[model samples]
Target: MVDARGLSCPMPVLMTQKAMKSKEDYYEVLVDNKTPCENVTRFAESQGYKVAVEEKNGEYLLKISK
Candidate 1:
């Protein structure tokens, strides 16, 4: 699991990419903003991972399943 809140754009996705590279199972990424969440989701999709996103309490929760 990775919490990317308070991080700027691309950083969150970069971190997420790293996390995914180190894991062979599912991963969860938490971001405070929407743009990062969208970018991460798109990246996950492009990598052949299943992506799920939910917005709650002004935060975004992104789940990636390989």
Candidate 2:
């Protein structure tokens, strides 16, 4: 899992992208705000992964898979 919580915009997306380089079929990204969540989701989707977001408390958990 890429823990992007407490991080800002491009950082979350960058972290997610770095994790994706592992060539895994599935990845999980945790972000504290909606902007990072949406940004990461878009990045993952653009890379051909399907993104599913879940909200817990005030954070977002993004499940990205091919």
Candidate 3:
């Protein structure tokens, strides 16, 4: 899981990229705002992962899986 809460923009995307480098089948990215959530989801999907999003308490949890 990549905890990207309190982080912004490229930071969240960068963390997700690093985690993806591990070649894991699935990953979860957490972010507090819409921009990071959208950015991370886009990055994951562009990499061919299926992206699922859950919103709770104004935060977003993105589940990315092959």
Candidate whose lDDT is highest: 3
lDDT of 2 by residue, 1-66 (tens): 999999998999988888888899999999999899889989999999999999999999898999
Give the clash count for each candidate.
0, 0, 0
lDDT of 3 by residue, 1-66 (tens): 999999989999999999999999999999999999999988999999999999999999998999
lDDT by residue (1-66, candidate 1, tens digit) is 899999978899899888877757798999999889889999899988998898899899998898
C-alpha RMSD in Å of predicted model 1 compared with the true structure = 0.9
Deviation of model 2 at 45, angstroms: 0.3
> Can you tell me which runs of candidate 1 are displaced by over 4 Å?
none
Ranking by TM-score: 3, 2, 1
**Every candidate's lDDT:** 0.89, 0.92, 0.95
What TM-score do all the candidates reach, one by one? 0.92, 0.97, 0.97
Best-to-worst order by lDDT is 3, 2, 1
lDDT of 3 at 45: 90
